[model samples]
Target: MLISRFELSVARRQLLHNRGQTLLTLGVVATSVTLIVFLATLIGGLQRRIIGDTTSMIPHVVVSAPERLPLAPWELPSATAPAAPLFVGRVVKLEQRLRKIEDWPAVVARLRELMPGGVAARVAVAEGQGVVSRESNRKPVTLVGAVPAEFTRVVDLQSNLAAGRYLGLNGGEAVIGYKLAADLNLRLGDRVRVLSSEAVSADFLVAGIVDTGIAVIDRSSLFLNLKDAQSLLNLGSAVTRIGLRLDDVFDASRQRERLEQYLPYEINDWMRDNQRVLSGIRAQNDSSRMIIVFTVLASGLAVASIMVMSVTRKIQEIGILKAIGAKSRQILVIFALQGLAVCAAGAALGCAVGWVLCDALGRIEVVVSATGRTAQLFPVANEPFYYGLAAGLAVVSGVLASLYPAWSASRVDPIHVIRGQ
Candidate 1:
């Protein structure tokens, strides 16, 4: 039997009789919902950031032949570049034919010939850490020496410029990231000294300031001309790493397999280079999802508790209905309706509040890392989905939680209450 309007009214009155408990329950539900949404949103942003570079910025294939000799860990000309083991360029001496080269300007050449469109810009690399001085204070930065136009094709250097312009190959010019410039108190045309282990006396003019938005890059990256880099590092034409950019970033594994025919060098995608960091991000994402489930479960418990309290307070009303010949099922229907009302209302409120908060948090800044390099949150940022999922989970939980309590209310022992037993 369905609960009647009169019974529903009685139940509603009973629920409102204690304003404090109702408010307390609502507060608990809302808080749990919010926490679940916030954590999911944060993890979602991290996933988007890590995948964006690979999916959008990187290419499908990369080719590089290994050198015949052993590769050692390379130290930047300064100390700014990430510390990493050097590759053995021994395979670099091989001139094997590519059995099934798909793209012309065969990717094999990218590692061996050092020709145009090769894996890396054909030039010298002077890597090292340096401190850009600003009057009295200094900021640590990564310094790279490479040609602008060619280097940009592999990695867009010009796009990072925030003030003035990027440097040309003429030499005697430098580009500093915005954060580094801020630390160094440098402006366009300002002369800045660059010191590296390769050389004791080296300096260049600040032609531009770059803003990577990535805290690490903005504060620690400096671009120098390839000629200047080669001269400073004394590499002549030796390059430490061949950064291969493919036409399709997702197909890197296939490309790596194919490139092996011509180039003996090992080819690793960006993800491979930064597996530890990416793994950490994945673990965090899993943890966030688990937390959401527990949070929703907690909210469900609140719904149950509220219903229990509502049922307990309505014994007198139950007694009156029973005396009037109403069956226990009918009496239970009224309380169940009341429980449904609270659960549904709470779910809707929680969803709305969670969505808004997650979207707003997305506006917060995030830092992401990849390939021994770190980049700040860029254009591909998206984190709202996480919050939405959390809210959906909450709604489902609310409904499920209400069911058991509603059933319990419907099974009340009306005879005892009416007889005052």
Candidate 2:
């Protein structure tokens, strides 16, 4: 029901008469909203930072050759009799040979067409296991080969370089991880011999040292030219896999599903490999939501208590209005308007305070790792959606909390109240 001007005026006057109480109720509501906004922004920022760091150097989706499997016993041909049932014997697992995608260029082209703007970058990679040695010091490493320009777009190798330049277009140049360099007692411009698992060996100049902050990659990863790696691994014009970075990291799983429909290659996304991290992030979000719900409910109860007291104090006033031919609905509307006004003001104030808090906290920097390798400011997601959500919840809570107290005020009997009962 719409509140008339007279009822609104009466509500305004009543609220102003008890300025201190009204302000206190507003402060309670504002505090609840502030907490909700702060928690939501903080949790969201942390999750983004975690996911960003984890996927920084990795591809969101990987397309590779599917695993080869031997035929089942039932599918085997019967040499003795064409119609006779095949006898089942002991089953033996066949070792998979070298896995490589020969038609990777066509696959990459197809991915580009299917995804359009969804894929930010894609690169074909020829990778293999090899051992790098400098004199007596030796270290095993996973060697990756790709075009420098294209690979950097996918893996961001340029930004993560600790020393020297990334791989050049020429052969006989290698980029080794800092940890691997340290283990081999190697330095920039130092000569090292890398022997592939297939017994192919080549000498290379250490063109760069990269420290990606990921322990496994930093310790055992190496980079070389596509031709060099392919030659070393004994793969003729074939790439082991194609890596794709998406515009939205979260779209990895959906893109993977879409690609798997038409592509014959095996497809994998980062989300599939990081289930534990995803679970932890989801848990944090769930806890934050629970806390926000309880906070708003507590604030609603506080508003209800204050409104109840207001109704008790103004019982005589309410009776006087009813005796003057004022309807019970009008009395109810007056109080409900008071509740809405307080909540609306409180929501505005709370949004301002929450933004200030988030901004201040975002400036405080902290070291993320013990090695002092990386430092970052506190993450605070400044999303307008959070502000809107908090305001909406507060307003709804206010309306609901006002109902019972307003109903009680409307039920007051003018005859009994004026008779001193």
Candidate 3:
């Protein structure tokens, strides 16, 4: 039976009789709601840190060669032709396409042409995988090639340098990420051999060390002069990618498209390259939404249990009411409303508690390792609206829990209790 005015009044009276039980159930529901919100906030903060770190180190737009199935796994011969052993990059001559966008060449030259006189273009070579050998241990490393001075113009590589000096364009030296250096037991004066798939091997003196704190980069990356990498790869004047630096980094996608038209070869921006990371983060967020649902259901259980016990204790009262001409449907309405009242109260309390806890947590400071930046961690302004969602979940659970008990209460045989049988 549906709830009625008289039944609603009775449900209210029953809840009023047990103040402590009502509050306790509210507390549990609210706690669970707060926990889920807090977790979501933490995850969001971590993602922001990763994006900030990545953008600071790499350009918003990074142009690379046309997509090709990378060289064969078992064939060293695939890296370079015999006569040009050591140069390992794909090249395309575009004399008619690029270098014509007004001042593109002057402002956006390759590494060799990049001068400190305000030019912003730079070329880079990237060897995806290699072994950094030291003593009896060999650790994997990502070897990058760039003209150090020119590269820093596009990427903030200088700020990350923790020790020594930048490798000169003409020098056969390399700069290693702090984590990679630590693993291979390298120091400023140490020398390591870089063997490419092209079978053109070369040794570079460790000139510097840098700590970016980003585990992905710090633990695996090493930088050498672009000329050195090109020499080893057998590319005399070619590079794997051309990285562009600009004033408004956020407008990279537009610039990337423009550059693609200007060049004969292919190019890719940062977002395209890091799509997997973005997708994973979004998926995790979608899954976290269920946390609030479970909390509300648990709260509903408390309301159900309380209503059931109340009905048993008031069986005689119920019989008296029935004997006085109250309908079975009336009794059912009264009990159902009581369940609704309990849920409503709990939902209100849960929402309040969620807001208080979330606000308090936001004032707390946390250091995220991914970006090496400390932040006051908390949900943004619209975060409290999520509490509404949690409360709704609890209300649904409460209604369902109350249903069985309300039905059983409605079927109570009045004559047996009223006549004292």
Candidate 4:
């Protein structure tokens, strides 16, 4: 007990004697640790935001018919054949293999049963290409026919509306993208002519104009009632694809593969399709880690330098302590305690600094280029694990940096020092 008290007392005295140096050392450690934590929080928040935006905009898994079809060489010209049409050959009308999901309600029910609570939503969509024309102006638009009630379960398209309501699938009603509306010079109640590939044309009232923040979706997409779309596209009671939002998007690819064994369809998972975006996120994480590593080294070096100088100045005191009956181990413990004390104080202040910085950063608006929108307020991840990690790193650096100086102080010779040599 006495030895412990004496070591602590000596450590306190040394720290107090060099108050300016002690504060400087603490400031260095605190600054580095604050930066480490701030970077971590910023990265974590951005990752979550990106993932949320991606998953919300696109389905985690999409089950659809295989787009490619095997062609008969006898009916069609071979690749090596002349580019000119075979005028002598029998004329055949070009037809798209337009596969559709049959008995879709039953399929969705069966999938829900198979996965239990793992699926969040399953929406059926009928997709096709069509031309929207107003007077002389005409542009191709991608048509997505959906049951508003079910589609909302997968994507909250209603919430992103810039004008009017979502498609209720009522007679002759459709919702258009913002860019599409602008191209057609349309308003909430305006009527536009939609021409299908089958030469069928219909005039529909513009129910809503949506700005999804995704430029591609906003520029060329339109939504209408499924039954109306089927009639217009000459597809009878069939859907082109089924979109699924899972409880855990990370497991989407694996679950999609498993579903493909029983379901005769192609499955597209977001993670597999968006590898480029994910790769960019990973590169950012690597950069944040590198920054943290350098900051830790800087803190360690600062502590080491301060401890070394302190030991040099206290060499005579160390020799007297040994002569008076303090053991080498006691002297080592004193210096080690000083390092611990400095780290403890710095960590407390660093946490406060990090919190303030993180809050300030979170208030700033960040422009999301991919979405063509600004995030009004940035987010910060306040997970407990980050604080624990920062504290652990600081403590580790402090101990390692103090070791050599403490050892050197403990090895001081009392006889040589007292003899005035």
Each prediction's RMSD over C-alphas, in Å, is 11.2, 3.8, 11.2, 5.8
Residue-level lDDT of model 4, residues 95-161, one tens digit each, is: 7645678677777787787678778888888888889888898989888888888787787687777
Off by over 4 Å in 4: 1-17, 46-53, 67-94, 149-153, 156-159, 167-172, 198-202, 225-231, 234-236, 366-373, 376-388, 416-421
Residue 134 alpha-carbon offset, candidate 2, angstroms: 2.9
Tens digits of per-residue lDDT for model 2, 1-421: 4878889899999999999989998998899889888988888899988898778888899999988765665666666344755665766555635689998888888888888898889999999898988888788989999998999999988888888888464699998888888888878999999999888999999998888888888889989989999999999999999999999999999999998998888999999999999999999989988998999999899999999999999999999999999999999999899999999999989999999999898878776433344544768887899899998999899879988899999999999889978
lDDT agreement with native, every candidate: 0.60, 0.88, 0.66, 0.82
| Candidate 4 Cα RMSD after full superposition onto the native fold (Å) | 5.8
| Clash number for each model | 31, 0, 7, 0
User: Over 4 Å off in model 2, which ranges?
Assistant: 70-97, 156-159, 163-174, 185-191, 203-208, 369-372
The TM-scores of all predictions, comma-separated, are: 0.55, 0.84, 0.50, 0.80
Give me the candidate number with maximum lDDT: 2
Clashing residue pairs, backbone N/CA/C < 3 A, model 4:
none
RMSD of 1: 11.2
Which one wins on TM-score?
2
Instruction: Determine which window of 10 residues in candidate 4 has minimal summed lDDT.
Output: 85-94
Residue 189 in model 1: lDDT: 88
Point out the higher-scoring one by TM-score: 1 or 4. Answer: 4
